[model samples]
Target: MRNSSPPLEVGIARWIEVMRRNLLLASIVALGVFGIAAVVIAKLPNVYRAETRILVNPQRISDKYVSSTVSMGPAERLNTLSQQILSTSRLEAITTELNLYPKERQALGRDRVIDLMRHHITIDLKQSSDGPSAFTISYTGGSAQEVATVTNRLAASFIDWNLRDREQEAQGTTLFLEKELATSKSELDALEERLRVYKVQHLGQLPNELDANLQTLSRLQVQLQANSDAQNRLDQQALLSRSGSYDASGEQGENPQAGLRSQLVARDVQAHRDLAELHSHYTAAHPDVISKEAEVASLDAQLTQTPASVSSRTRRSGSVASPADAQETSIHHSRDHLAAEQRQIESSINNYQSRVNGVPIREQEISQLLRDYDTAKEHYRSLLEKTYTAQMSMELERGQEGGSFTLLDPAQVPDAPIGPNRPVLYSMFLVASLVAGLLVIALRERLDSTVKSDGELHDILPHIPVLGLIPRISKTIVNRSPAQPTLRRAS
Candidate 1:
């Protein structure tokens, strides 16, 4: 006999049995996937990382020109120097010396090692956020010890570069100034010579005053000539009177007005001045011009009314006027007047020359100014050149600077491996189990089709006496395998 039951419990049992069967299949598939994943993960190569830290401080802070008002700050100088270290040329040197890329890099003749070094390297600057300083260097690499070694090398190189730069900059600057000094001195000397020559050639010469003196001398000379002419005429008249050489009767006679040969002095000067103005303004036939012209003619006639003559010592002692004495006195008077005018002119010329001679001194000052300008320019250029050299040297020194790093913590060998994720393996295994279980369920359902249950049993034998019903147990929940446990099928 079999035990009878409702369909609901049997359905629940079958549902659970199906899930159990699926779970078993899933487990098998999961195991296989997890094993493969584990092997693959283990076969991958491992990479090790290395790092080093360093600090930067000035190695030599000796101030040679502390008194100089203009100088650069240390930080500015250091930073500028640091930037120059990133150049490939410097890296190439280090790489060659360190056997970094390969010894065959020299043989293969490829400078590609420089690029490799740059790629493998990393520099991290650790600046103080709270302080006014930023001079730390950090290098990282795949090789643990190599990173530190390279970092150390960089510091050393930078220091060497800095020293060399300073030395060269100083020497070079000095040389440049020296050359400029030479050129400036030469220019100054030439200017001096020119001034000296000018002074020697134009000694005791004056320009502005000389012209003024010359004009005065000319006027005075004219006056002296007039005076001499008057004196000569007076003497000549006197001589003529003594000899009775000329008279209105065309014979030698004495006349009191003869010695007094002074003409109408300055009388025609106004008329001459008016005539000149009229000549510029109008034609000579103007009315005012004709009246002044007639007046001038009348004055001339009055002045010529008396013939110029001189009286002799007539009958006082019956003295004969000595012609020889008169002639000698006239010559002596002419010589004396001419000599006085010449003396005045010479004195003026000498004064002018004396002033003109001072120009050479002024010229010398100009020459000095030119020399100073040249010297200053030369020094400026020299200093500029030195600045560049110093900057370059500082950069190299910073790069090779040995104190750029500090060993905060050194890496030590570890006893256990850091990783191959074991939990991820377990999760993968679970996922594979679900997939395989579903596949098995679908395949079995397709092959075997059945609809046997409690309701169907009642329908098949309704006339038969229903004695008992039995429940089908799920294979998954049975808790025993055919090979592991004794089993019996329900009947």
Candidate 2:
């Protein structure tokens, strides 16, 4: 009896049986597909690839001392170089100059050719433990010589572009720093000028001069006080000289009018001294000045009256003029000089006091100016330093001493084609053909209802009982002669 397993649960033996029944059909399908693949692969054109390796050389000078203005890393630099070199205009120029892709250009136009060339060109970065240390520029083409030339051209373009870009960046940085420095300097100068003008406008009243101003004011005050004391002493001396000379009994010695004249003279000196003191402290239009002037005028009137009275009395009484009269006149002149001196001292005191009082306001103004000036000076100094650095970097780039690309390995004509590796492709196509053959076998088996296996028949009729089996007759025995048909056909 046959096994009753389902047909869908096929084992290795069942799979072998299925494969055997369709082996010829499977072979024809697989071989036919493989033959077509072999023909197509053989007819395909050979593509050549050429590469140029470039090392990303750092600045010759140490970065610690003269850092390059361009701070891009190796990978980023290569990418930027790739974009710039592979730009439409640049590629177009290279294509025209090198006469690259001439057939593609004719067939597909300039734009399409550029796209194809771009696709064919590749830039691959080589990274190390440190970073991307080098990169390769490769171009694929039909001809080895053309690919090598184009690759070398691209490498040259990258190097040249890196140098030119670095220089421009350095120069641009320098120019920007210079402009900022100029602006900062202008601001600093303006602040300085303002400070100078402010100091000049308020010479004695600046913050730094506050202490000196106070000291000066104190000195002037003392001098003024001393001057006033001296004036008082002169006043006493003048009074003493104007008084009449006494006899041995301390009697009035000269004319009787001497006593009245002495009194008038002392009053006049006191009034003049008071007027000078007031004139120092107040302006001409002040009330104190007005009052002092009125008092002085009254004293002058009193002097005129006393002198006239003394003269009349002296003439009427036939009294001799005092011998001390000339001394009295000289003393009066000295008093007048001392009073003028006192007034000058008092004026100086007032001037210095004004300066002292203005210290706080001037100090505030000057402090503001100083703060702004200091800030601007700092900014200008920083900008100056940056500008100097940028200039040095620019010079370094111009000298080709900064970060640059060195062609480590120039592209050369390849002896062998880089693509259409026939053996690998042939193996891959062989796999695809096998898969196609399996698919065809599966489709053919799915559509046919013929039960080739007892397992398949059992799957369709699970409840059926098989009591006996009919053995398959061999084709050789069926084609045998009928003369042997009466004999039992048993092996």
Candidate 3:
């Protein structure tokens, strides 16, 4: 079998010969492809991009004292602004105002024009360790001036929109707080009115007056005690006077001492009745009940002592006699005087006891009213404070002291176009054309299967061997040779 692989040097020589044979065709193809690329590159339009830089500045006031209500970060805010600025309506407005994409508008209508304009716009956010967050707004157009104008307009619109949005947010918050404050104030007023009415309805029963009520109760109790003691002393005096001896005969039926005793007994009965009435209203532990018991005991002791002292006096005066008629008349007058004194004392005691009994009831009622009033007052105060804070925050936003975007760099008309890079396009086209030319040469070389060298001839017919060889010569070289001498003889 014949070896199919040729030596490297022989293969290289064979390729060189093939290239030389096809040199003219390869050069023509390469030049044609390069020409087409140049024409296509020259016809493409240039695109110019203009950019504006915006810095997201921190709030003027420290956040430690007053924080900004706008909580969005630079990237998020940029995205939101981008959506708003690039919306259909906004882009349409920009397109109409700037006379942008006029040909596209005519060819594809308003929506397509707006879409094209949106496609031309771009936003990019930039952040650095040492500086605040910033972003760039850029627009591309066929003309440098138009691109710059559109970019600047978009930037200005964003700034205006941001300011307006912030102010509106602040004003809206303020308005809402104002309404809440009004509602809270109304509620507070209603509570105050209700409290006032409650206090009026239960005048003496408020908690704040508990101490004073206790003090008055104590004073009244003391007064009631004093009056009881005086009534008891009078009763004792009347009892002692009544205990004195009296003659049965030649006596007017009314004994002076006896009338006085009768009057004292009636006053004692009235006191017992008043005590029973007090028991129905108050417990035994109550001061009024205790005082009444002490008075009753004192009156009983006075009555018991008076009878013994009278018995002793009667025994000592056994030998003495007196007219009974004069005694009886004097007794009647004395008894009337005692009765009047007893009635006055009883009235004073009753008045004091009533005052003491009423104090605790009044205190409990007043306490409830005061508690409700205090609760309402506290709520009102809290709402007032919150309203004040809301007002301050609104004012801060109105003053434009919160986080905001500042135009760091305005868009300027570019001196040069940013796109339709002719050099790069030309380079790419050059490479593509060279590759096509090479591919065409390789395809032509592959299709032409004729033997061109000794190694190829050997591969085609390895069984045959040749002793003599005929060398090939160019037709031009053969024709250029001098003619043989036979031509001269014929002439």
RMSD of model 2 against the true structure: 7.8
What is candidate 1's CA lDDT for residue 62? 32
Q: Tell me the lDDT of model 3 at 209.
A: 55
RMSD for each of the candidates? 11.5, 7.8, 8.3
List the global CA lDDT of all models.
0.52, 0.80, 0.69
Candidate 2's residue-wise lDDT over 1-491, tens digit each? 34565545567677788899899999999999999999999999899999989998878999888877788877887888788888899999999998987878878888898899999998888888888889888999998889999999898889999998889989999999998888898999999999999989999988788888878876766666567667667777767754433322143444455566677767866876776576546544679878887887887687777642243324544766554555657776876787678667767766777887788888888889999999999889888988888999999999999988999999999999978899999999999999999999999989988977666677788788656556666768767857455545553
Residue pairs with backbone overlap in model 2: none
Q: Number of the top candidate by TM-score?
A: 2
Please rank every candidate by TM-score, starting with the best.
Answer: 2, 3, 1
Q: Give RMSD (Å) of candidate 3 vs. truth.
A: 8.3
Backbone clashes, each candidate: 34, 0, 6
* Regions more than 4 Å wrong, model 2: 1-42, 245-323, 423-491
Candidate 3 colliding pairs: 205-362, 205-366, 206-366, 207-366, 207-367, 256-331
lDDT of 2 at 473: 62
Candidate 2 global TM-score: 0.72
Worst 10 residues of 1 by lDDT: 65-74
Q: Which candidate model has the greater lDDT, 2 or 3?
A: 2
